[model samples]
Every structure is written in C-alpha cells, then in structure tokens.
Target chain A: MRSLSVPSSPVRDLLALTSRPEVISFAGGLPAPELFDLDGLRAAADRALTRRTLQYAPTEGDADLREQVAARLTARGLPTRPDELLITTGSQQALTLVVTALLEPGSVVAVEEPTYLAALQCFHLAGARVVAVPGDERGIDPVALAEVVERDRPELLYLVPTFANPTGRTLDAERRAEVLRVAERSGLRVLEDDPYSELRYRGDAVPALAASSDLVLHLGTFSKIGAPGLRVGWLRAPEELMPALVVTKQAADLHTSAFDQAVVADYLRESDLDAHVRRLCATYRERRDALVGALAAVLPEGAVRTDPDGGMFVWVRLPGEVDAAVVLRRALERDVAFVPGASFYAGEPDRATMRLSFTTGAPEVIREGVRRLGEVL
Target chain B: MRSLSVPSSPVRDLLALTSRPEVISFAGGLPAPELFDLDGLRAAADRALTRRTLQYAPTEGDADLREQVAARLTARGLPTRPDELLITTGSQQALTLVVTALLEPGSVVAVEEPTYLAALQCFHLAGARVVAVPGDERGIDPVALAEVVERDRPELLYLVPTFANPTGRTLDAERRAEVLRVAERSGLRVLEDDPYSELRYRGDAVPALAASSDLVLHLGTFSKIGAPGLRVGWLRAPEELMPALVVTKQAADLHTSAFDQAVVADYLRESDLDAHVRRLCATYRERRDALVGALAAVLPEGAVRTDPDGGMFVWVRLPGEVDAAVVLRRALERDVAFVPGASFYAGEPDRATMRLSFTTGAPEVIREGVRRLGEVL
Candidate 1:
C-alpha cells in the first residue's frame, strides 16, 4: 500500500530521459515560459511587499485575492462571491482538499476512464474505490456515467469538462447537460476541473457545469494563464461544502502563501490578464496545429490522434496491439519523448495509447519533435 | 464526524472580538511584522525573478533551497543532507504530510498534553486516535510517555521539544535523553517540531532530538524567523520515509510555490539569517520579559504562567476553576486577548489554563495589555 502510492509508471521513468536539452520533449504539461508576464508580476511583487504580506493571514484566504478571483469568475459566466471561493496552492491542492473533505475511506469515486494521473493519486491516498466511466471523443459518456453511478453509488463524479488534462477533450455542451442530469438523478456530486478552459484556441467557450448546477465544485488555476511557479489556484464550492473544505484546507497548509495571493491579486488589478491569455491562446493554437498537422503527416495509416481545438495535449492511438511504452523507448533513443497514455487511466489501460503535449514548444520545435517521433514509428 | 473537524473553540469565537483596532491581541502566534526584512526579501525577489521562478518545479522542491536548508540544519547541530529533507508549505503542512505518510486510519498517536491545536486537527482529519501524555512545565514526562507507548503502542510520539507552541516550554536536556530511550524501547518514531529554537531569547541550546535519534522526523520552518507569509518550511526524515513523504507532498500542493522557494533560497544565500535571527531574539527577549514581569506584578495570587526561555507563547493556569473563556470575555471587554488553553488539549479540558503570546506585541504594548488583564482579574 505504501509503495503503490508512489508512481512507478514507465512514462515517468521515460520522462527522465527527456530532460536532456537536445530532447524537444512533448512530455510535461508546462506552460510556455516565454509567455509569463515577468514585468507585470515584478510590479505586483513591488506593490505586495508590505509587512502585512509577511504575516499569517486568515485560514480562508486573502480577502482581496478572493474578491479578485470572485470578480473574474463572475465575469467568466459563473457568479461567485468571495466567501464561496477557497484559494489554494494550485488547483491540484483544491482537488486534494475536495477529496479530503467529501470522501471517507473506501468511499466510491467515479472518474473519466483515463483521468488526470495526480487526481488518481489523490483518490488512492484517501483509500477511495475509483471506478472509471467509459467515454469517447466528447469526454465522459453520460450513459456509462449513469450506469457507474447507479451501480457503484459513487459519492462524487470527477470531471475535466473543458480541455481536460491528458485527453484535451471538452465534454460537448449536450453531453455536459446529460452528465449533470445523470448526477442529479443519482445524487452524485461533480467536481469540474477547468484548468484549460482559458487556453482555448479556436472553439467557442462553453458555459461551465457550475453555471447551471450548484452541485458542481468548479476548480480553476493560474498555473495555465498567470504562471505555474506561483502555484496559485482556487475552488468555487457550494456554500454548504465551504466549512468542511475550509477545515481540510487549514489542516493542509494553513492557507496558500500570503505573499503569492497578494501578488496575484495585485497583478490581476494592474495587468491585462485577458490580453495575456489571448496572446497565449494565439501561440498555443499555432503549436497545437503544428503537432496535429505533423502527426497526421507522419504516423502509420492506422494511427489516429485527436485534433484538439484547445489545451495542451493531443491524445493518440497507435495501430493494433502496439505498446506506447515501446514507442516511448524508441523515441527517447531519438531524443524525443511523450507520455504513455496507459499511465493516465484508472481502469485497464489501452496499451496502444499515448499523449503529446504542445504547449511547451514553439510550433516549429513541436513539428521537429514529432518529426523525430515519426522516425521512431 | 464532519463538524468535529471544524473547531468551534470559544477562543476562536472570542478572537473575533479582539480584531477591533482598539484591542491589543496576543491571541495569534504571529511573528513580529516590524521585524520582517523587507529590503533583503525585495532584493532576493529581484534576484529570484527568472522564468524558472514562475515555472513548475520538482515536487521535492527547488534544489538550491533544499541545499540552503541542509546547510542551515547542519550548522545548527543536526547533520542534514539536501536529499534527506522535503520542502513544505510550512511546518504545519510538514505535520500533515508526516501524519499522512506514517499513520493509518485509527493509528495511535501520542502527543504532549496541550499540544498545538492544528496538529490535533491534522490527526483528527486522518482519523487517528490521539492520546495526550501528561506533563508539567518541563514538557512531556518521559515516564508517562513510556507508559502510553507500552499500553497504547502508539505508532508515533509527537513533540515540540524546543520552545513549543502554546506552552513555550523546552523539554529539559535530561528528559530529552529519557524520551529518546523511551522511543527506542518502544520502536516509536518522534516528530520533533522545532519551529522556535532559532527564536531563543535566553539559555544555551539543546541538541535537537533528531541529533540523538534517527527515528526523529524533525520539522522546521521559516515562518517565525524569516516570514510566515512565505509559508516555507521543511522536514528532515529517514531515507525510508522520503518516497511516501514526497508522494504525499506532491498530492498536497505540487510542492510549495516555486517563486517563494526560490526567493527564500536567494534570501538565505545573500543575507545573514543568523544575524537577523539574533536581532529578532534580542527584541523578543524584551517583549517576553515585559509580559512575564507584568503578569508577576498584577495577576492574582494563585495565577501562574511559564517564564519561557524562548518561543511565542507563555502558558498560564488561572486560579482554580476560573474558566479561561470567562477570563477571555472580560479581557475582550478591556480590549485585550489571549487563547483559552482548553482549546489546545485533545483529551480533556483545563478550564483554568490559557496561552498568552509575547511575540506579537511590543514590550510596552504587551505591558499595557497585561495591565488591562489585571483590571479584569
């Protein structure tokens, strides 16, 4: 049980090889460093470096930061009050807090078949019984979700409804409504992890599940748009759940760093975050096209990949019985790398699957990395 | 079980009253804001504002920061290596991680009576059985601890051996050895939470419990000396524990903020933390003296408080059956505040006990606040 908590995935082992500067790795879901607004953050730091910024803050979070996030979330179609939000180290921590607050040991949790790996780790740590709801192009299949919910009596249904990690698939608006209905009928709560919504390149934005349902615990992060290193994120939870979440959060880290929260709030007030996100979307859109176009041009005839409209990843399925780990090994020999999709799944893995991330590289660089991958294939 | 996790302590209730501008609050264990090295930190932040500072870092923590912490711990008597430590949000999170890594649900954890409130909260969150080992002013009694270990067979013995929070009592050198012997006899691991050793205002330092026992998981933090707002701390553990600790920490917050870690590293590198600590110690000494002297002169005959040599708090036992909450209400009316000590205990209430913090208020302000308490008495 102890060792199982630590990931020994072939993908993680292979990722170690991609650290060489020569490897134009499409492995990590890291945001483009060139896009981080250093000047704006520096100015924010200047404004935030007060005595109050160095003291212990309220357990809930910095009031002004919550207000800023509340305003932004409200502007984004989800009406949120400051008190309704809990600022976290990152949305990752927000997920951990939710799992801790809502689930008891051995409680059932239903997640997408191939969900975020770290979320799986959180559920694992909590001793949760995780059942995967099968899905296809439009994210979690509502029929399967309802079946899983009714059979397992899952306390929570976790989703990445928009541009999800690993998959880069947004649940279609129709499916989102169906999923909510399934949840409502089964009395299952949904955790909407929305880290990639703002990174959309081409698709029109869908209203978040939380926009229609208070039962949804909506999670968001500055890691994608602001800066990952700052490690600032938040969860907008139903008021009924706030007390337990607060208690769990307090037990977790007291609160997110006061200095980071203050700086983020100041940056939001002073800088053009919308413009910065627009620039990011523009660049990522190009990179996404480059990876998609390159994969289409190079891979074997039976090989298939998702041409995601937005977000970091492009999920791929290789020709019959082809192991992604074997492909990863060959790619690394050529100084190229990507994660084996098997690592992302909660249930039995499809050994033929792999994920390619596009956000870290320039379009040309991503094309070249895929070009090397084609040699391996 | 859910509501039990949320603290509804009368002290927390009364603390709201002390937030008014007129009140002089020693209710929180906050570091002195005036003492924060703003210029040094600003310079550090200036040096730390690289693209990497805003990018996601290794889950274990930044390499440079761990090395700096390793060096500091080595210099302070306990030999440490960078690899042996895991960087955390604060020692608070360190406690949480240790609990997650070591204890299972219903695992027995023996803590010093009137332990830090948040530590109890973490144990409660994990569903651990917490038993308090009774002690006097010299901290946890080794014989009583041995009895608890023999009878309860607690998997862990948690202590803040050096200048503990709330109590501010340092376990004497003799007792430290006895406790180590007790731990060895029982095969029980000790978590020495030593956040305040550097803030010592008087007396020669005792070697940390970690210095004598490899079984000790030593927790230290920058919150008191550097700044709480940064939320930086570390835990030094045995090699066997690192894998589980790292995994738990990764799931906790994806490592503490990368920017905060880098800035703290740069600050530690460029600045003389020892000299800053010395300056802090000097000032806190006077404040400690003022609170102690004032209490001696004015408190009614049966009232007693520890004359702590170091740390943030001074634990007091008011005259028999005089509820600390009742005293707090009267003191709040006088615009003064302290935490009622019953809140810190896990086993049973000590209605006559309370904790007064000397770190937050200046000597003159502390004396004035104590004078107001005298009026209420």
Candidate 2:
C-alpha cells in the first residue's frame, strides 16, 4: 500500500524538545503548572464524578458547562445562550470543527500572515486554499485584509483578534468594528479567536466583533485561565452554524469528556476563578517584561521585538543576515529553546523571526534564558 | 457569508433521548454505572493529580499509560511497544483519526453490511465511497469480503472482529484466520474495533486477529472496563501511519488531557482491573441472559435474535410487518428504548431489525423492560 503524506508541524516537534531538562524552552505556549488551582480542581473533580457525570454526555457538551461558558461571554458583554455554544476539547478543536464544517476542499480561506501555526495547519488539513494578508504589530492590516478578500474571494477569514498566538498582538476596538464592517461588505465569514484576551495586564478589554456582527464566530478557552489539563473550550457562532458544527463534532469524537466538563463547571461555581486569572496575569506580566527587557540588551543589531499589552508570547524578528532556525540550533547549544516563525505563515515565511513564550518560566528564569540566547547570538 | 450544511447523525439524536429518567434506555451502548469502580478510580485520581500530571502531556500520550496499554496488549497475545500506541479522546476519535489520515475525498472504504453507525458517519465525513460486504452470524462473509475488496479496491476495511457492534457477532477462529488470509493476499488494511471484547460473559476468549496480521489497526478503550466519562482510548497501528495521524491529532486538539491519562495509568497500576472486569462480566452475563430469555417470548413468530458470545447488544430481527422505528416510537411511550437498525446499514437498511443493549440494566430490569417491549409489539 502507498503511504499517505502530510508535513510534520514544526511547533509540535519543538514541544518534544522541552522535555530535555537542560533546555530553558519558550517553544510551547504552555501554562505554568505551579499556578494551577489544583486544590480547587480536586474539590471540583470530587463533586463531579457522580453517576450522572459518568454517563455519555450530549454531543454539544455538558449543559452546565455550556451555560457557564455562556454566562462568561455575557460577563464580557458578548451575551450568548447555552444552546448557541458548542463545547470543545480545547479551542483548537472548536477551530478545527468550524473549519471542517464550513470549508470544502479547494475553498479559499484568508488568514493573517504569520498567524497561529495550528490554525494554518487546521485550514490546510481541511484542504482549503490559504491566502495570507499582511499585518502590523497592532493586528491584521485592514487594508491588506480587504484587498486580499476582494482578490482571493475567500469563504472565510481566520483571525486571532485578541492576544494572538506567536505575535501576542491585539487589535483595537475601532479596528475590530472596521474589520467586522469589511467582513459584512465582502461577504466573508470571520473566525474571531480570543483565548488570551482575559489575560490582560496593561490594557482595556476590547469587545469582540462577534458581539456586534453575525458573521463572526467567537472562540474562547479555559486552558489559560483555569487548567489546561481539563481540556475545555467553547465556540460561540450564529445559531445557523451550530448544526453543521455539531454534526462534525459528533463524527470527530462523540463528545469531550463529560466528567471533565462537570469538574470545570464545579470549579467555575465554587472557586475564585476571577482572582486566579488575575494572579496569572500579574505573574505573566512580570515574565513578559523580563523577556522583552532582556531582548534589547541581548540582540546585536537590526533585531526588533513586539511589546505586547498582555499574553504568553513575544515575537522577535532577527537581523536579516541570521536565520531563526539556525539561531535556534545555536541557542540549543546554550540550552535555550524558542519556536522559529517559519511555520506560522500561509505564504512566504519570515525565516528570520521567532516566537518566545513567557508562560512556562518566571521572571528570573526568563532573564537567564534570554541571556543564554544572547550568548548563542 | 454563506451557511454551510451537514446532516445530523441519527444515533447522536438518539443518545439525547437516554437522558430522560422515565425511559429505560437500551439505545446507548452504555456500561453499567454501578459496575464503575468509583472507589478505585478516586484513589487513582488522587494519586495522579500531581504537578506533572497538570502540565501538558506528550501528543503520543503519557509514557506510563502507553506502557500499561502495551502490557495489556501483550496479555492479549499482541505484544506492542509504547511507541506504537497513540492515545485519543475516545475510540471514536481513534476511528476518526484512522479515517482522516488514510482516506481522502471519494476514497473507497469497505464496511460490514450493518456496522457501527458512527463509523459510517465518519466515512461519510471523509467523503468516502463506502461499500458494504455481507456477513453471517459469526462475522463478515469471507467470499463476499474478497469480492468487494477486488471490486471496490478500498483504502481500508473497518471491522469489529470481536463482539461487533449492532450485530454482536464475533468471527470464529477459522473464519478469522480465513479473513486475515484474504486481507493479507488482497493488501487491505483492517481497522479492528474491539471495544467490547473484554466484556465477555459466556464464551472462550478469542485471540485477536491483530495478534497475527500486520495490516490490522487495533482500537481499545477504558470506557467499558474503567469508566466512559474519562474519555480515554488508544490505537495501535504500523509506525508508517503514526506521523500523519499525530499531525491530524495535533491540529485537532493538542493532546488528550494529561490528568485523565495519569488517572487511568494510576488506576491500572493500583487497582485489580482483572478482578474488576471479571465482576463486570459476571454482572452483564445475568443481564444478557434475562434479555435473551425475554426476547424469545416477546418477539413475533418470524422474529429471531442472535445470542452474542460477549458484548452489550443482542441484535434482533422483528416480524416482517413491524417497522423498528415505529416499534422504538411506541416503546418510548411505555418508557423503554432500543435503537432502530436502519441507520446501521451502508446500503439497503433492515427496517424490521433492532439492537437492544443489556449493559445498562440488571436481570430484573432487563426482564421487565423486555416484557414491556413485548406489550408494544
């Protein structure tokens, strides 16, 4: 039999490297284990593993979790109903299901240049033609997005509107409204991903375009806020899209774990998630400042890094003469690891750029890691 | 911009009905909740929710859980390595991954005449051309399978070799050998779904065909033996297919929950799973006998039922005039439920057939439920 072929995800391979004890890794966007509310989670799990929780749950997910998620959305000003939300294993599954259910083979889907690597992979796996629209530090370039959508005539535009992966960029409220108008005018669906908006340390919350636009599909996850090991996330789209997504989810996996959902729901009710998230923001802000602060002292010349308002990552563009992958190899020699930015782009890649996650390490570790990275350079 | 469309899975809707307390549900292939080793699982969960378990796990799975699974496989006469196993959200996800990695749009996949409805939905989602091969009481008809493979030249053959779904049919030693020989000679890849093999009540345990065949891709789950709510399952396949499968899984959801994996791994280590399964087998055996004994008295003159060697279901062909769907509708009025058989077929459906699961009820409940079903008939 002939072997089927698919490219290995560069980020996934980098995740494998983090297990090496010597490596101070910024390769994976993992949450800090020390910060997890384990005591709260244990109590939640204890209360949730009853007879009702042991049975198979609905395809959409546990009703209590869905309602809780909807309430969270409402708390953020994007009011939603339990029935309108589809619970997922994580936001990744929500994105994958949304893409799979909507896009067909050869269907064009426009994405921001150097976007979340996994989203690009999901779109590619759907057999969609991925068109890249250039973006600045703020977020997707609206002019570029409008032009690309008009020219490519893509079915959907995938965007990480708030605290985007790899870049840690957040679009302003005015730009979000403009993008929504553009999407409506261009007849393009917008996937508004907002996993890290809640982790803000130095910025006002920008309401999601999904709150105002019918064309936007909103995605949120508890991985950053609550516990990643629970593997809980949700998607809020228009009522019409739920059936197709639910059907696809049924085919993918009957449903996410019921007991896990119950545990998360229990935690949401009994624990101080708001305070816990605030604590996460406070800790991550220090780590982010330390890493960004070190970059200036470390880099030689012609290298620039984004100063994110809040999130897990800081994106750096290396000097033109140096390749990020090559630098990564050298950095590993000094036991520092970061993901090269080549894999995130839909079209021509920024081979001289890299993404460093500040989530796994503390301020001191971050400083030392950046110093080691500087030594390699 | 435009609304996408996808058909709802029939069984998914059917599963929704089982939540009503008044309904005696034989519709869902659920394990007996009372049989769930809750005390053991609690101890395991307590042991597992450490700092490491709260962090992200390898995409392949927990090394310890994989080793445990491999050891279990060895006990079944199919010695596997930890590297060969990939943990999934459930066995459903395993099937989805196998189909996603192996089959493309319009790829041919051979299935049994009446197979697991979810598998059919998965094949359809992959845009596959499914061809059904006829089967007898024991298992798939070898001659028919050979003809279909020659004609359809399918990329894969999905089988439930031990305790097949819907039919509750097991391939006898001779038939299994012949089927394996045919598969080898024809170069047909086999997906052996053996979720219910461990639940045997009154028969000799047949060594899996996967133990001998290189073409076989084996799937297993903890849902039946340990708990369904945990949503832990795994697959063992040739190394060649692992990369593509892993890539798809990465894009789907980073990985299964690390805490769930650790919990199951701890349970495997600390609990007497062998004794627990034996207890399950003994309990289910009585239920099976009650249901089978009642079915003979309940069904009409021409109706017939297959006595499963092991598994949750007893497949019954009702009287010619009675439609299974109609019977289901009527039975629900009397607070009893069984899945109609039509959706299980790839081609022409058996409208007069139905499947009753014996796993959810005890002997008394099974007898009473069956007698109530008889009244409706």
Candidate 3:
C-alpha cells in the first residue's frame, strides 16, 4: 500500500523550536490571544448550548451562521447569499475541499511564488502539479501570471490578494483586474483566500475578486477576527460548484462543529464584531510599526523589507549572500526567531529572505524581539 | 479539472424527507438530544473559554485531552499512551485521515457487506477499490474475511465490531480473535471502529482488537455519549503510522476545534460520564424492546429481524418479494420513516432489508411509529 507522501513541514518544525517561553519569536502565524473576547464568547456559548445546537447540523452549514456570514460579506461589497456559502472547519479546510471538488491527481495548479505554505501542502497532498506565478512588491505580477498560465495551462490559480500571509502584500485594484483578465482569457478558475482582509489597520477594503467574476471561489475565516480555537471558516463559490463541494464536504468530515457554529452565529448577533476588529487593528498596527521601524534601523544597507499597510507579517529580504536560515540558527542561539522564507516557495528557493509575524507581541515586546535578532545579524 | 466524483448520499437525502415535525423518523443515527448534559457542558465551556483555548493549538491535539482519552482507553483494556493518539473532527474525519495516510489511489480495502455508508464514500473518494466481506448474525464471518483478503489482497480491513450501524451486531470474543488471526497471517491492517461500545445496555464488554494486535487502529468518538455537535473523536494507531497521521491531520484542518476539545476535556474531568451513559442506556433499551416487540407482532409471517443486545439500530428482512424502498414511500405518507437498508451495501443490495433506529423516541412513541410502519407494510 502507498501513502500520499507529504513532506514534513520545515516551517512547523522551526516554529516548535521557537515555542520556548524564553524565546521572543516572530515565527508563528497566530493571532494575539489577549485580544480575544472571552466574556462575549462565554456568553455566546452559554446561550448556544441547547438541544438544537448539540445535534448534527446540515453538511452545508448552520443556516443562521451562513446567513450571518453572507450578510457580512455583502456589507463588504461582495454580494453573497447564504446558499452560496459552505461553512468549513477553517479556511484551511476550505482549500482542501476546493481541491477535492475542482482538481484531480496530476492536474496543473498555479500559485503565487512564496504563497501560503499550508495551501501549497494541500495541493501537493491532492497530487496536483504546482506551477509558480512570480510576484513583485505590488503583489502577483500580472504579466508573469499570464506567462505562467499560458505555459502551464493550470486549471486553478490560488491567490491571497488582500494583505497576504508571510508577505503581507495587497493587490491594488488595477492589478486585481489585470490578474482576473488574464484568468478570464485563459479560462482559468481562481481561489481568492481573504483571511486577513478584515485585519487591515489603515487601508480601505478592496472589492473581492469574486465580486467581479463568477469563476472565482472566495474563502474567509473568523480565525483572525473572532478566535482561531473555534475552527470556523466559510467558502463562497459559484452555483455550479456547490453540489460537488457539498458532496465532498460530507465525505470529508460530515460537517464542521455545529456547537461552534452556533456560538459564532450568536456571538455575531449579540456582540460588536466591528468594534472588536477595530481594537485588534489598533494594537496590531502599533506592533507592526515597532517591528518595521526596528528592522530598518538594524538591517544592513542592502537589505529591504515590505512595509505593509496592514496584516500580521513583514517580509524581509536580507543583504546579498546572507542566508536567512543561517541567520535563524544564530538568532535561535539568542532566543530570538523568525521564519526563513524558503519554506513558503512552490518553486525556486529564496535563501536570503525571512517572514516576521508581529501579531503575537506588543510594541515593546516586538521591539525587544527584533533587538535580539539585530545582535545575531 | 476533475472532482472527486463521490455520489450524493441517498441516505442523507432520504433523511431530509424524514425531518418534518409530523414524521417519526427511525431513519437517523442520531443520539437523543434530551440526554445531553447541557448544564454540565455549559460549565465546562465557561471554564474552557480562556486565552489558551481560543488560540491555535498543536495539530496532534491538546495534551490534556489526549491524556484523558488515553486513561479511559487504558481503563477499558487497551493500553495506550497520549502520544499514540490523534484527535480528529468526529471519528468520521478519522476515516478520511486513515485513508489518506495508508491507501493510495486504487488500493484495495475489505469491509463488511453492509457497512457504514459514509466509510464507503470516503474510500471511494480516495479512489480505493472496496470489496465486501459477507457476515452472518454474529458480525463479520471470519471465513469470508479470510477468503476475501486472500483473493483480493486487500491492504486493510474495516470493521465496526461492537454495535455496528445499520445492523447493531457485535463481534463475539471468539470471532474477534479469529478475525485478528486471519489479519495477522495475511499482513492486513484492521480498523476497529468502536463508536457505540459505551452505550451497551446488556452483555459483557469485548476487548478491543487493538488490545491483541499492534496492527489494529482503534477509533472512538464522544458523539454517542456526549454530543455529535462537538465533533470530538480520537484515533489510536501504531507508532509507525503516527507521523503520517499527524501530518495528514495538520493538512486536513490544522486540528480539531481547540475550544470544543478543551470543553470536552473539562467536562470529562468535572462530570460523571458513566452515569450519563447509563441514563442513555436505560432509556434506549426500553425503546429498543418496544420497537422490536412491535415489529414482531406486526410483520408478515416468515419475516426475520435482528434483536440487537445494545446500540441504536435493529436490522430487519421482510418476507419474500418485499421492497424496502417501496415500503418507505408508503410509510412516509403516514408520517413514519426508516432507512432502506440497500444504501448500506457495498456489493449487491438486498431489496427486502430495512434498518430501524430506537434511540429517538420513548417506548410508547416508538411503538406508535412501528404501528404506522406496520400499516404501510
């Protein structure tokens, strides 16, 4: 018998090393736990623990939760209906479900060069061939995307277009339209994963790619805004794909946790999610500023980093010949950590790059973490 | 692009029809909602709603919950370590993880003739070729299992040994040993699904197959005893398989809900689960007797039925020339429902068979539902 043969994650292994309490680590993609609404969530759980909430729910999702999600998406400029969405364990499960519904083994998929590592792993587990579409400071390079699409004939193109993970790059309106045009011309489908859109600290929200094209599948998660421990997310797809996705979801796990879904729905109804998000943005923005300012002052003259408008990460490109992995080893010796960017690639390695997450620490703590990294460098 | 090609479940679709308030459905495999420990669970949730429980946790699972699950399994006769277990989203997700970890596309798997339908769908979704091993009254026939393994050269054997779905037959101790012997000789892996073992109303407990063989992967769930809405389950596997299973679990949904896991752990610590289960057994046993007795008094002469010692369902075979599906249509018209047993078979279906669940109603209500079913027949 043969197995799926997924490679052990280097990033996850590295994160484990940084988990020691003594280490000031920027290696994890986790939300700040201090920001969670404990009392609000506890109240929601109290109200939601009823006979209806304790029963097996529909495979699509809890209808009230779906309606709540749909309404929020519509308010954000993406017109959605409850029927168009399928609740998932997290947006991570949404990626797996999408792959199950849309791609087969050996089918070609295009992903951004250094995309979300978990998404790359999902595609590989499904036995799909991944082709990388190079990106620039402005996010995915439309010309490069077109070239890759023409060459590889990929069935699906995966993007994290709004305040993306690891890189924290947002595609401008013009760039998003150009990417969609390329996909449309090539008859390709796009999966727009927008988990960090609502985490924006400064910029106005951009319309989702799904709002403009029926071919795009949209994914959103409450992990960043509500709580990751709930494991709740949703996928919005075109009408044609829902049947297969629902069937695949039922086979995958029957459904996501009904009690969690009910609690989330009640929380949305009885609490101020917008106010909660604003508080998160206020704290995270300060942390981000601290990390970026500290990095600029310490790094060598040739080094460059993306100063994102929002999101959790600041992607840094070290000076020429300065390998990030080597730096990470030395940094670990000083109880400081960041992820070497090579682990996020779907194609060629970039050894002189790294990703730092600023969400888990305060401004002072983040500055302290970067100070330790500065000494290692 | 190609989808996984899993067919929509006929049973799930049939269940949607049975959901009307007027219908008395023995079609669902749902635990009684009133039996849930609402207050106890709410208290647990209140305590578990902490910063730790609201953040991303280890993909392997919460260490505390694993320790508790391990201790319970150890007390029940299977010696286990916390590290040997992986928490999943219900045991349903456990089936998907096992399929991903062990079976590649086109690998052969052996299952009982009329097995858990969802398991069949999961195997098929992974492109595995499933072959059915016929069973008699005492669960899977060891002789038939040996012949199928020898002929088909299946890599794995799946059995719901104690109080199985569709047919609540339990494997006797002698038959369990024989099945393990055949598996050992053939170098076959066995998946011992024991979801309903804790709900026993009569008979002595049988040792899990994992107790006797390291090759057996044991699956258990809190769905039956606690609540399915929590979607908490665990799988115990050999050390050789744990790495792949952990990796697969990470790729599946990062991990099961940390909030739910923490609540379940706290509930187990703070509440008396044995007493709750005993209460469930007492009620369900009376309902089972009522359903069985009613069927015996009403079914046509020559019809045969299984009087299960414990668990949710009782399988029935009507007299000659009967079609269970046709009877279901007539029964539904009278606001009474059951699952036609043909949907459970992996091989040829028996048109005369049907499955009735007794856990959803009181004894008087169960008798009334069966009386309506009698009129339709």
Candidates in order: C-alpha RMSD to true structure? 1.5, 1.5, 1.1
lDDT-sorted candidate list, best first = 3, 1, 2
Over the stretch B1-377, how does candidate 2's per-residue lDDT look in tens digits? 22456678888778877879888888989898888888898888888887787776678888999999999889878889999999999899999989888888889999988999999999988889999999989789999998988888987989998888999999899988988888999888899998999988876899887888889999999998888888899999899889998988888888898888999999998889999999999988888898999889988888889999889999999876678999899999999999999999999998998998999897888888988898998
Tens digit of per-residue lDDT, candidate 2, span A150-209: 798999998887888889888888788878888999778899888898899896888888
Encode model 3's per-residue lDDT on B86-144: one tens digit a residue. Answer: 99999999999999889988999999978889998888888899999999889999999
TM-score of chain A of each: 0.97, 0.98, 0.98
User: Each candidate's DockQ score against the native complex?
Assistant: 0.65, 0.64, 0.74
Instruction: For model 1, state the Cα shift of residue B344 in Å.
Output: 1.5
TM-score of 2: 0.98
- Per-residue lDDT over A1-377 for candidate 3, one digit per residue giving the tens place of the 0 to 100 score: 65535567676687697679999989999999988999899899999888888888899999999999999999989999999999999989999999978998899999988899989988988889999888888889999998988888999999999888779999999999999999899889999999999888787888899999998999999999999999999999998898889988888788999999999999998999999999999999899999999998898889989988888899999888888999999999999989999988999879999999999988898888888998987
Greater DockQ among 2 and 3 belongs to 3
Who wins the DockQ comparison?
A: 3
For candidate 2 chain B, which ten residues in a row score worst on lDDT? B1-10
lDDT of 1 by residue, A1-377 (tens): 13425654344355576679999888888899999999999999888988998888877889999999999999998899999999999999999999988887789999998988888889988889999998899989999988887788998989988888788888999999999999888677899999989888886889999998878999999999999898899999999888888878888888899999999999998899999999999899999999999999888999889888788999999999999999988888898989989988899999899988998898889889989999988
The runs of at least 3 residues in candidate 3 whose Cα sits more than 4 Å from the true structure, single-residue gaps closed, are B3-5
